[model samples]
Target: MITFILRRLATGVAMLVTISITAFVLLNLGATDTARRLVGQTASAEIVARKAAELGLDRPLGERFFEWITAALTGDLGRSWQSGQSVVDAIATRLPVTLSLTIGAVIVSAALAIALGALAAGRRGWTDRVVQVLSVIGGAIPGFLIALILVLVFAISLRWFPATGYVRPEDSLGGWLATIALPVIALSIGAIGSVAQQVRGSMIDALRHDYVRTLRARGLPHHRVVYRHVLRNAAGPALSTLGLQFIVMFGGAVIVEQVFSLPGIGQSAVAATVVGDVPFVMGIVIVTAILVVIVNLAVDLLQGWLNPKVRLS
Candidate 1:
């Protein structure tokens, strides 16, 4: 297990390095006159040169990357060109806001999907048909559209959840939950559909296996036979898909944050990119890549643990 973790860590590092390099290259390639752009199109030559020196844009690519990596390793993500704040600090401040939405969405999506999927697989009448039809429709709808509908209904009409802005959990747990509930639902509605479909397919396949028949023949209760025997076997794939969906949720949060007027890494990232804030953009990219890699690694390790055959191979 230690070896496995070490290996995964190495892979994660390599992936991070690649991401950083790509971001750095793209940034440099587009911003050839970095200092000129930083100041303004009308800035004098001396001012441009001075800003260039301050930014170290004149340095060789290798040295710049080394310094950038060194700073990143120390969590000093440089200053945002746009806001003039420490990029790392900016992202850190917003991280929890985005995390709250993403984590809440994950919980809701997984629970809703698993219940619907399992029921659809186990039952053969209206319950099955309804789950199937809803999954299709839900998957077809964009998350932003879903979010708007939710805002219109829950926030504007019913006035159950806050229309915009995030409430700090420390201030009021109830308010925070209510504030986040709609966004979470909006973020997860599509995920619920996709995951449910995967689960339904996997469960149906698992039910046909000889082990399921053996469990049923032994007179195990219907729920146990389906949930314990079938669901467990099916979960490996479903969980893998869920991991990918978590990453998708992170990306989708950017657009959703805009619609809801929530201050988060997603919102910050967009502003940074729009203004050519290389340091901030690079910071966001590296953080996001690390998260994606870590989640995928966890899924791999989990699958190995759940299935001995996977570990063996």
Candidate 2:
């Protein structure tokens, strides 16, 4: 298990390094003159050139990347070129909002997926058809549209939740949950559909397996045979799908944050990218990549726990 964990961590580190370098190169290589943007467009050419030089846009890419990575390793991501705020500090402030939405969505989606998927698999009639239809509808709709509908219905019409903004869980727990509820539901629809489909398929296959039959023949109760044996076996694939959904939600969160005015890493990334805040954008990339790595590692650990053979492999 230790070896497996070490190997995954090493892979994650390599991935983070690769992503950081790529983001830096791409941001710098773009034609959108970061210096000119930093200065007013009406600024003289000479002034723009001087600004570029000051910002090290004149430096070789390799040299700049080396300096940036070294500083990053030492926990200095540099201040935003636009706002002059420490990149790390800016991200730290907003990370919790994104995490709350994403983690909440994941938890909701998983619970819904298990119940819907198991029902579809076990019942296998009109109930199965209904679940399949709902899954299809859920998967077909875009998340931003879902967010809009939720805001319109729950926030505007019913006034059950706030239409925009966020509240810290520490500040007011009820306010926090109410603020995040719509966003979480909007984010979860597609994930629940995808994961539930995977679960239903995996469960059906597991139910048909020889071991399931043997357990049943050995006088095991139907619920025990299904829940303890079949569901556990089916969960491995569903978990992988759910992990992928978690990553997808980050992208969706960008649009959702804009619609709902939630301050999060997604919103920060958008703001930074618009002004070509290279250091801040790079910080967002690194932090998001690190999160993806951590989630992937968690999924791997869960899979290993569920099936010991995964650790051996």
Candidate 3:
């Protein structure tokens, strides 16, 4: 187990390094005279040159990356070129909002998917057909479209949830939940469909195995056999699906945030990119990559726990 964990950590580190390098290169490649942008178009050529040199834009790409990465290791992600705000501090301020939405979405997705999947697999009639059809419709709808519909029904029309903005749990727990409810629902719909399908398939397969028959023959209750035994066996694939969906949720949050006007890292990211705030944008990339690594690592550990066979691989 120790070796497995160590190996996973090493792989995560390598992945982070590769992702950072790729993001850095892509951002730099299309960069258009950052110094000029900083000093303004009205600035003289010499002023632009001075600004470039001052900001180390004149330095080689490799040297700049080394300095940035070294500082990042110690938690210095640099300042936003536009706002002069510490990148780490800026992200810290808004990170909770995004985390609230995405994490809430994941939890809701997992719970609903497992229930729907188990029902569909065990019942295997109208219940199964209904779940299958709903899954397809859910998967077909885009998160942004879902967000729009949710806002219209739950926020604007029904007035159940807030239409826009975020409320920290620190401010008001009820407000926080109310604010995030719609966004979480929007982001979770597609994930629920995908994960439910995986869970249904895995559960069906597990139920057909000889072990299931043996458990039944032992006079175990139907619900107990299905929930405790079959469900556990089927969880591996559903977990993997959930893990992948978590990553995909981050991408979808950008559009959902826009639709709902939520104040999250997704909104901040869009603003940063629009103005070409490279330092801030790079900070977002690295932070997001770290999150992805952490989530994938957690999923791997969970999978290993659920199925010891996974640890061997």
Candidate 4:
């Protein structure tokens, strides 16, 4: 298990490196002159050139990439052109909000997906049919639309919670939760559907396996057979799917954050892009990529643990 984990971690690091290079190249290619943007429209050409030179933007692409990578490795994500704040500090300040939203949404979505999936799999009649319909509806709705509807119903009409903005959980746990409740629901909508579908499918497949048949023939009770044996066996594939869903949600959070006006990494990234803050944009990309890689590696380790036969092979 340790060996497998180490291998997966190595692979994840390599993947992150590749992702960093790709993001760096793409952002540089698409970006306008960050120095010019920083100095503003009123700045003269000579002033702009001087500013660019001062920022080392006048250096070769290879040198610039090296500097960026070095700074990133040392946890210096560079300064934001707009706010003139350290990118690291800006991200650190906002990280908690995004993390809270993402974690809450994932937990809710995962629990709901597992329960609904298990019910649908075990019942396989009216319960299953209803869940399938609902899942389809959820899958069809975009997250932004869901956020809008949630805000309208829960925040505007019902007035149950704040429609926008975020509160630190530590400041006022109740208020913080209330403020983000709608956004979490919106973010988890599609994830619930996708995860439920995967879980239901995997559970059904597990039930059909020879081991489950053998357990049933051995006079195991129906509930135990389904919940203990079947669900556990089915979890391997479902977990992999869940990891992929996490990746999807991470990206989707950007749009949802905007709709909800949450101060998260996603919101920062969007703002940076709109104003051409190259360093901040690149930092977001790198952080997101690293997270995805780590999650994927964790999934691989989980799969190995769940199915020891693979490790032996």
For model 3, residues 37-143, the per-residue Cα lDDT tens digits are 77888999999888777777778899989999999999999999889999999999988878888999999999999999999999999999999999999999999
Better of 1 and 3 by lDDT: 3
| Candidate 1 residue-wise lDDT, 1-313, digit = tens | 6666677789988988888898899987655476676788898988988887787787888898899889889879899987799887898899888889998999999999999999999997999999999999998899999999999998999988889988889999998898888889989998999999999999999898998889888999999998877898898989988999999999999989888988888888877776578898998898899888889888878987777666555
| Full candidate order by lDDT, most accurate first | 2, 3, 1, 4
Best by TM-score: 2
Q: Which ten contiguous residues of candidate 1 have the minimum total lDDT?
A: 29-38
Residues 1-313, model 4: lDDT tens digits: 7787777788878887888888777766633366667788788888888977776667777888998899889888899878889988898888777777777888989899999999999998999999999999998999999999998998999999898888887899899989888888988988898888888999999888899889989999989998887887788877887888787777888888888888888878877887678788877877778788788877776777788875664
Regions of candidate 4 where Cα sits further than 4 Å from its true position: 30-32
- In order, the Cα lDDT scores of the candidates are 0.87, 0.92, 0.91, 0.83
Instruction: Tell me which of candidates 1 and 2 scores higher on TM-score.
Output: 2
**Which of candidates 1 and 2 is the stronger one according to lDDT?**
2
Q: Kindly report which residue pairs in candidate 4 clash with one another.
A: none
Off by over 4 Å in 1: none
